[model samples]
Target: MIIDCHNHVLATALPPGHDRFVREMRAPGHRRAGRLPAYRPATDEDWVGLEGDLDPIDPGTLVDDHVSAGVDRATVLAVAPSTYTAYGERGTIDLGRVTDVDGPLEVAKSNDYIASLTRRHPELIGMSAVNPKFRGVEWARDELTRAVGELGLQGLKLYPMYDHYAPADRDLAFPIYERAVELGIGVMVHMGTSSAKDTVLDYGRPGALDEVARHFPDLPLLVCHAGFPWVDECLAMVARHDNTYLDISMFATKSTQRQLYEFLLRARQLGCPLSRICWGTDYPGGGKPAVLLPKLTLVNDVADPGAPISRLDVANMVGGNWARFAGLTDWSEQETLEQLEAWEPRWRDS
Candidate 1:
C-alpha cells in the first residue's frame, strides 16, 4: 500500500477570515505574539501566492485525486487555531484568524468535517485538532475525547506555535496528550518555523517536543515537516526517543529529493530507525502528490556511497512505516515493484 501520512483537505482545514486576518496582522507596526519576526516582511509581495492557499476545495475530490495517483490511504488533520491572547502591548492587531477570537466551535466543526470525510472514504484517516491555550485545557481534553469516541478520529493535530502556546507546558498541553494516550491515538504536532506572521517562534522549535516525547512515551508523536532548518536536531530527538517519528511533508519534494535523501542517509548514521520515518505531502496547502510523489522513488537514486537507502527503505518511507506506526492492521504491501514497474520509466528523467 502507498500511504500519505500527512495531508489537509483545504475546505475545512482553515477557519474563516484566516487569510485576511493573517494579512492584517502582518501590517507595519502590528503587535506579534512572541518576538519580532525573525525575518520581517518587506512588502505585500512577501505574502503573495497565499490567495490560493486558503481556497476551500472539495475534500472528496481531493481523495479521488490521491486514489488516482496510486495512494491507497491518506491522513487529514483538522486545522484548529487558538484564540489570540490578551497581553499588554502598544501595537495594532486585527482578527489574525477567525478561530483566534472565537471559542472551540470552529474546532468541533472542523473535526466534524474531517470525520465526515473519513466516513465517506475509508481510505482517509482523520485527526482532530485542539488548542489547549485558548479553549482551556479541560475543554481541549474533552474535545479530543469526543472526537475519538464519537467522531471516530484516529489522532490529534496540534499547532503550538501558530496558536501561541508552549508545547512543552506541562499544565497546558499535557492534559491533552494524556487524553490521546487514554484514547489510544497518535498526535501530529506542527514542528519548526511557521509561515504565519503572528506565530510565536519561541514555541515552534522541535526541541520543545523532546519534553513531550519524554513525558508521554506511550503517545506516538509524529513531528511534521521533519523540523526543517532544524533537521539535525529533529533527527537527534527521533534517535533519542523511540516513541517519536518524523514525517517529510514540506521537507521532501521533486526539487529537494536529493536533500531528503541526504537527511535519510544522515538518519541511518544517527541510529534513527528508518521504520519510524514516514512519507507525507501537506497537500492542498504545502506539498502535493504531483509535486512530491515521483520524488518518493527518486530518492533511492541519491541514496548511495555506503549504507544506502534501499528500495525496501523507500517502501517503508512511503507506506509501511505509517501503517505500522498508526496501527493500520488492514494495510498490506500491495504496491510491489512488479505492480509499479510500468510507471517506473515515467518516474525517471527524460
Candidate 2:
C-alpha cells in the first residue's frame, strides 16, 4: 500500500477575514512574501482555493486522489491557522494583543476532525499539529495525550519557524518534546523554506535537530521537505541517528528531485538504508498529483535505473515507511501487494 507520509489539508473553519490577510501577506511586495512565487488568491467556490479541476479537499475526494495516484493510504496533516497570520516581518506573534487562548485547542479540534475522517476511512491516518509556544509545555503535553490516547492521531506536526522560534531552542520547547517522548507519538517538523515572514532560515536547518534527537533517542522524528537547501545535512543527520527519517515533501521540481536522488544514492553508498527515506507530496503546496507526476517519475527512474520501482518501494513512500516508523502494522504487506497487482495492469494501460 502506498502512503503519503506528509500532505496538508486546510480546514474550512479559518476565521472570517483571515483568508484575505493570508493572501495579502503572501502577495508580492508584501513584507512577509513567501519564498516561492506568489499563488493566485483562492476563490470562494474553489476546492481549497487551489487552481485545477482537482478533487475536493474533503475526505472522499482525498481518498479518491490517493487511489488514483496508486496510493492506498495517506497521512494527512492540518496546516496551522497561524501559518497565515501576519506577525510583522519576523513571524512573531504579539501575545499581549491576542484574545484567543484557544489557539492550541482549536488546533486539537481540527486534529480530531481529521482523525474522525481517518476512522471512517481506515486507509487514512491523521497527524496532529501543535504550536509549542502558544500551547506551551503543559497544554502541549495534554493535547499530545489527547491526540494519541483519545483521537488516535498517528503523529504530530510542528512549524517552529511559523511560531517565531527555532527548533533547537529547548528552553521553551523541551517540555513538549519530553511529553512527546513519553507519549510515543512521532514528530514531523517543517525544516525547509519559509512561507511566513517571521521564519528564520537558520532555525530550519537540520543541524539544529541534532540536540533534540540526542535528547530523545527513542522518539522517531522526521524532518519534512527533505530539509531542502540543506538536503546534504539532513542526509548526514539521518545517517548518524537511527531514530531520524526524511520525508520528501515539496520536492517536485526536476532539479531538486535530481539532487535528492543523488543524495539517496550517496547515502546508499555509505551503507544507509533506503528505508530511512519516505515520500510526501506536501499536497496543496505541491499542487495536484498530475503536476507532481513528472517529479515522482524522475525519482522512480533514478532509484531503480532500469526496471520500475517495486510496488513495495512505492508503498514504502506512500505510507508503509510511516506506518513502520509509527509502529503501527495493522495493514498487511500481502494485502498491499494484492492491491498493487490488481492495479498494475491499469497503470500500464494508462
Candidate 3:
C-alpha cells in the first residue's frame, strides 16, 4: 500500500490563512532565495501580503484525490497556525496572554475537526496538534488524552519552529511527551526546514529531540521532513535510537530527487535501517504523490550502485514503514528489513 504520512485537509468553512514560500523568500535570510536563483521572487508586489492560499478543500475531495492517485491511505493532521504563528514570531509571549486566549478554543475545534474526519473516513488516519507553550502544558496534555482516548486520533504532532519553542524544553514539552507515551500513540514533530515567515530555525533542529528520545525510550518519535539540510544529524539520531523514526516529507520533489536519493544511499551504507524511515509528501502543504512516487525509485537506475536498491526498498519508504509506525503491521515481523541490513552503499570508492 502507498501511504503519504504527512498531510492536512484544511478546514473548508473557516480555513486559516498561511505564510507562503514567497514570503519566506522575502524574509531577510531565507537561504532558498540565495541558493536557488530560479526561486528568488523578482517583484515588489510579491511582498504585498504574507498570506497565501486558504487551502480549503472538502475532506471528501481530499480522499478522492488520494484514491485517484493510487495512494491507499494518508495521515491527516490539524495545525492551528493562525492561533500561534503570528503571535509567537518574536520568540516571546506574555504569560498573561496565554491562559484566556481564544487560540486554545480554536485549537480544540481543529482537533475535533480531524477527529470527525477519522471517524467518517477509514482511508484517513488522524493526528491531533498541540502547542504546549500557546496554551499551558497541562491543558494541552488533557486535550491530548481526550483526543486519543475519546476522539480516536492515532498520534500527536508538534510544531516547534512555527510556534517558536525548542522541542526539548523540559517544562513545556516533556509533559506532553509523557502524556503521549501513556496514551500509547506515536508523536510526529515538525523538525527541519521551515519556509514560513518569522520561524526560528534553531527550534526545528532534530538534535533537540535526542534528549526527548532518551527520556522516553519506548515512545515512537517521528522527525518530520527528516531534518533536511541537517539530514546527517537526523540519520545519526535515527541510527542511535531504536525509538526514533523519520518522515521524509518535503524532499521528494523534482528539485531534490538526487539529494534525497544520495542521502538514503549513504544512510543505508552506514546501516541506518530504512524500515524506520517513512515517506511523507507534506500534501496540501506541498507534494504530488503521482509525481514524487516515481522519483523514489530513481536510486535503482544507478548502474554501478554497490547493491542495487530493490523495489521493496521503495515500497518500505512508500508505505511499509508507515504501516508499521501506524500500528497496521507488526514491526517485529518485518522480513525484508533483513535484506536491507546486508545491503552495501555506492559501488565507487571515493
Candidate 1, overall lDDT? 0.71
TM-score of each: 0.82, 0.76, 0.78
Against the true structure, whose TM-score is highest? 1
* lDDT by residue (tens digit), candidate 1, 252-333: 7423777777787788888888889998988755545755777876666666667566777777788888877776776555
lDDT of 3 by residue, 17-54 (tens): 23233334335432344532356653535443433343
For model 1 the TM-score comes to 0.82
Q: Count the backbone clashes (under 3 Å) in each candidate.
A: 1, 5, 0
Candidate 3: where is the Cα deviation over 4 Å? 11-52, 80-84, 87-105, 254-256, 303-306, 330-350
Better of 1 and 2 by lDDT: 1
RMSD, each candidate, Å?
6.5, 6.7, 7.8
Residue 250, candidate 2: C-alpha displacement in angstroms: 0.8
Write candidate 2's Cα lDDT for 235-285 as tens digits.
Answer: 788888899888877754424656655666676665556677777777654
Candidate 2 achieves a global lDDT of: 0.63
Where model 1 places Cα greater than 4 Å from the true spot, the runs are: 11-16, 21-51, 85-107, 305-307, 334-342
